[model samples]
Target chain A: MRYFFKTIHLIDYKNIVPKTVIGLFIILILLIPVFTRNVVTLSTLIMTGIWAVAAMGFTLVLRTGQFSLGQSAFMALGGYASAILTAQMGLPFWPSFLVSGLVSGLIALLVGMVVLRVGGIYFSIITLALGEIVRIIALQWEPLTRGSRGIIASAPPPIILGGHELVNFNASLAPYFYFMICLVAVTGLVFWRIGESRLGRTFAGTALNPVLAEHQGIYLMKYRVIAFTVAGVFTGYAGALYTHFLQVITPMVFGLWQSIQIMIMSIVGGIGSLVGGPIVGSILLYNLGEYLSRLDTPGLQSFLFGSVVVIVVMFLPQGAGLVNLWERFWNKVVWREEEYEPDEPED
Target chain B: MPPAEILIEGLTQSCIYMTMAFGMVLVFSILGILNWTHGQLFMLGAFIVFYSTTAAGIPFPIGILLAGLVMAGIGILIKKFIIDRIKGELYIGVATLALIFALEGAASLLFTSDDRGLAIILPGVLNLGVVAISYQKMAVIIFTLIVMTAMYFVLNHTKVGLAIRAVAQQPVAASLYGISTERLSLIVMGIGCALAAMAGAIMAPLYPINPFIGRTPMIMALLAIVIGGLGSLTGAIVGGLILGFLHSVIAYYISYLSEVVLFGLIILILLVRPQGLFGASAK
Candidate 1:
């Protein structure tokens, strides 16, 4: 009888509340198309979702304690691959998307084999160089990439169900927005699961101290490579989707500026919280840029963005994620006196 | 182009890259943070020279001096306000990146995004057996030599230079020996900024000045630093010359693909010798 009770307690639905909240939030997002028909707003939301996916990828690499400045290179590779496949080879969008992601992951695997040998700042510098190399190649390889003129796809592939075309992505913003939201949601779930897994703990351990991790019998390089490859996969997916959405791709689209923006999103969202941090950061910063641009000051957005990054790093080094703030707020509401008592011991 | 002409062009480019790399190495040694804004400061210096010479009616030499002084002041202020407060490699990187964006934005707004150029102070070309070298290029080479010689003297013989070196070698020990690491860092930042500004001011007459112009030289300086070894000054110089020569020769042969080759070589070097050609293995 006692054993049965213990088992029952273990199976309690304590996690249901947050899950339901997330479900309802997702439902609300799904209902956005019904409520508003603003193309600009839909496009903005779509971009936010796209950036959120990339930022999440960046956060995964950061979890391994490696700063990668070559996200643009992977993104460009994926974009080019998808673009070339659909436009040049006449491949279907779905297959091209998958292949492009795999292509990026394959490149990451190869690059990671060599670059991961040097950790920390050296790794960052090599990645920067790598990004530049990729950009230059894209610029110079005129026959394949069409140089600065860029590639323009005719349309996003239509989803066919039971030999009938179900949805055309190129026709309207609503369907694309829905697709983006779905992608973002799925990516978030995957990242959250990874973060909660034993593998995630191992990545944390490796990041904290490579020597210590090695002492604990962790293959540091293996974990770093895995994390890097996973990041490349997600970033590549985002890039592929972005190509189809825009229907035109350029080497200049995924340059250092885009890379920096992704990094800023990850950092600003608070690097600690994998799911909420990046999504919130992407929305906030992207919208902030839009808002600043509307104010008619040409460089004010960039200036403010830079200032925000410096301030956030200095004051909230963990990031500006809402999870911690929410937890603190909940604690204050439920047990303020108990929380305050712990401070007395330090004093 | 003749081989002799390519060599001269390479040497001239190397001198500019060397000065920039020297400043980068100095700051990297002391602060242990790569200043992403270093290139922007170089741009700022050129603009200052442009304004002083064109708008304020100052002479070329005096304009260069003014740029150096102004940049030093800016560097000192940046150290005290932004860098001093930031700790750890990651935070410093982010902060410096932020500084780059802010400076770039300011430059775009203040100077307009258009490209500006300075009149060549020296216009005549010197004729040689197989090559005709411009006097402007000669001036750049001579100026670089003079600046480097003066830097060597200061670094080797001066008290402040000793203090700077001691702090870089062992911050705790130097502090124990009555050197203030804080003050030393501020001074080093100023000196580094001044050198970058001087390089910009000198190179301004040769190339068009723009808000985004610092990026290429900055990348070259970084590549030079990496090739020569991260913290070693001599390595930076050697790396700069090698890169400069490669750039000139490769661009001559392959036109636009020089950048691809240059970066590829850096990656190759890094894979084979992660410690750099002349640098000690990093701890």
Candidate 2:
């Protein structure tokens, strides 16, 4: 019975990826219209999309052996900058977006200069400090940010789909959800390409063995800076999406807790796992929390999250552990020697 | 504010900051990790004091002491069971993060996220010239000093402290001399956590107590330890003073920009001395 299943999987592996993706995405996209009539469902989908995009950006840096606990900080940087630009300055929506990305990129560029020097827990600590610094500035600069009172009614992006223009994407959650879906697809494609690029190889090598990579002329500093900047761009995209989703901006939006939560999402999705953002860690757990709160207080929610992390660290250590474990079992069932490792460049 | 009052507040605040920083330095000296949950341990201490005094009907002094002992136990368990198995900073980070969530969850479930003030150890005020100091706060300051001084003596003079220090300086070498470096780690965690707990118990009446209250002092302690160097016990105290004074002085004048100003100083300090002001190392 195992042999039959193995033979089928071995023959159908190439065809499986697209089918599975399409199957899940269709279920989700179909629910969009069905659930569009309900505001809460739409909001949830939109948020999940935005968070996934940001996590992908985070995943990019991890590929080159970098970690960012400051994702929410950049998100806030983009969110606030663009909100201020378009709403307060009356700038064009697209220009404000590009500006947001640029601001985040520039900030990342500057901070990354020193931050890149550190790695592991030190990296998380620096980013945590940086995030708090950003939060404090946002809170205290009441003239610009309006302090903890929070700014409301920051307008959303203008969407152009198939030449059909919608002025306010935030008017309804459906359009924003669709917009974020495109972002996820685009961000995933970009990250996959970068992960396969020579630059990514240098980063991967640096992460794998920094001393060796430096000896081989990988130029660790250059790649580190690039990875940080790229992360900034994608993170900014997520931020812009988040601002629209929440329909308000505040220093409270990007606290150290939020940053840690996002980091948890990326890590739970498994390090370097693209699109693991929504599926594995924070998003799934966060969604579960939201749903569970309808029944009881949110106290038990974090407990569940902690338990998940403990389990992952103890038993899995690799990822969700299901897929990786299944793949291993399938390999043994098929007796495929080539499945031992993928030495070729990532596709 | 009068000169004397300002001096009193500054000194007291600096003492609080130094106690927290001292605990942080101990962890780094022994475990070689920043122990992000150090702040949460401090938070638990506060909560435990509040619980023992208010809910369990214990006297203030007894409540505070019990809180310290209980939290120290939790700290040892964390070091032995959770942190012991993890390898690499990243994995340790993930594990501690799990602990953070768990602790926060427990805090939320048991005591609510809302901040609750604790009863003072000794209430009323003591007026001396321009300065009018709260007796409760003065007691906190005194307690803080005693603990800090006691810790300093133990670390510098005692046998167990010497063994712990020896392990921190060189784990491999210490183990060869039959130090049971692992056991020493548990003891260090206990001492570190006990100090943090005492700090929380003493300050419970001053600040509005909450599950996440640990966040601020931990950050301040981080600055103290980092500025002092990651593993420098003495640096932690010095850094704590620098940061504490930075807070009192800036918050006195700048108010809103105080946090930013403080971080700016830390960044400048770090740029100049990455190993910290004291230049301590884990190895």
Candidate 3:
């Protein structure tokens, strides 16, 4: 709950900004289906929940000055872990979800132990390579992943929790929608707490000045490894949820560009800013991509993304995503007008 | 012919990697920013030749020269207009990545995204013993060596090269000596881009050419430079050769696992020596 409220603080509530503004935005996301009475469209929001989860998980390490370009790899691993184990072996749903996430975490922990020792551009390049390696393995590991053709009909778990048997997947999308909402809520809470915690402070210090942090007696390498390993866990969980949502695991989803895309989303939104990344980054990027494809020029839209990045990085060093509009306005108008002369203070 | 053939083939492959890697290393050593668009520039060079010979009705020799000059002009212009304005190494990197995407977009929009084959030159085999190395293979090796020797002569002997080297080695000291460090950086990039374009043109005949084809080889070239040595020209050449031979041999043998093998080697090298094989310890 505090995590939820903390994100509220992340919002700009300072200058008598109407509470209705924020309230209306939240209501719009929640109450859209009610107004339209179309349950089908809620599906898009469900996937957005998964994107939120993955971004939150990724933000943990990215804040530590370590960019892991292996999100798609971890994601694919988590998705396949659950989909295969449950679909093929007939494992129960609850156990599969937990096991799938743990497997991704375990793999991440192992990779992190080895990979996180390297830093900066080298770290980014290596992670990207590792991602491709994993994707290639997934492509070749036909027995488990079904190769390039991908696995089909991997619907939501058939097993009922506490003996409450579930129906077909389409009929149960409503439940999955709320299920996603819960996942996002839980993820947001955990991520916010971690961001505000001692660990987060350590990460920030380590990122800014590792040598200084080390002199302060902090174990730099250990904390970085921890951050990366922990991030893997959440990304894995997000993947597991995403698998159920898509009900399919494909090699195409784990592409290197896709991994880069996720990275771009986070950075474009804003690093070190909570929830802004997923909202401003993932939702918008994903929506824009879809809108472009619908508008009959996917290539043109992608070109615009590249153009936008060039413009944004050139003009606004601070990302345009999730920026403080009010602060900008106040600085320009109010602060200028309120400047009093020093000579007037003679009394 | 048997073993000599394999050796010459390997040499040709190594020559390609070495040339491209040298270009990358030169830019990085001078600017400290990895030009992510380098691969595109390389690809652009190939397209320049392609467009020149096919569309503009230029002879092979003239087309190659024209393509090199065209690509270099673009590189120099990019450095002056966009990259020179950038503040820091990090921003330069981000900006270069943006350029890669934008160039890819422009290329795709202008040309088909499909692969385009270049006209074959020196297309015959030379039987050495058991190995029969092709004429094109020998030509590639000879051309690369020529480029390398040319670059070496210029860098070691010429006044401009000396100035560029001076600035790269120590910018503050060079500035005290009244050199424009910014102009020197641009010159370094321009030359690097020109060399990269030449590599692209030379290799076009041997491989598939496409707009986005620059990325993989570019990344590999960067890795090669890192593994060889970040700043040393000698390291760049040696590293490129090693990566090229390994990539070709591994791809031929393991097929799909080539990238996996390449990345695995990169990780291993970084873990062992992040400074690279030829790279000097950072100051």
Docking class of 3: acceptable
Please name the candidate that would achieve the greatest lDDT relative to the true structure.
1
* Candidate 3 per-residue lDDT over residues B97-195, each given as its tens digit: 767777887787777678998778777888867778777777777888788888889998998788878977897998899888788877788778887
DockQ of 1: 0.39
DockQ sort, best first: 3, 1, 2
Q: Give the TM-scores of the predictions, in the order they appear.
A: 0.93, 0.88, 0.88
Per-residue error at A268 for model 1, in Å? 1.8
Per-residue CA lDDT of candidate 1, range A90-131, in tens? 888778888998999899999998888876667877888888
Chain B of candidate 3 achieves a TM-score of 0.93
For every model in order, the fraction of real contacts preserved is: 0.54, 0.40, 0.36
Ranking by TM-score: 1, 3, 2
lDDT of model 1 at residue B152? 94
**For each candidate, what is the lDDT?**
0.81, 0.73, 0.72
Candidate 3: segments with Cα more than 4 A from true spot: A1-24, A36-49, A158-169, A172-177, A295-298, A318-347, B1-9, B85-89
Candidate 2, residue A331: how far the Cα is off, in Å: 4.6
RMSD of each: 6.0, 5.5, 5.5
What TM-score applies to chain A of candidate 1? 0.88
lDDT of 1 at A63: 82
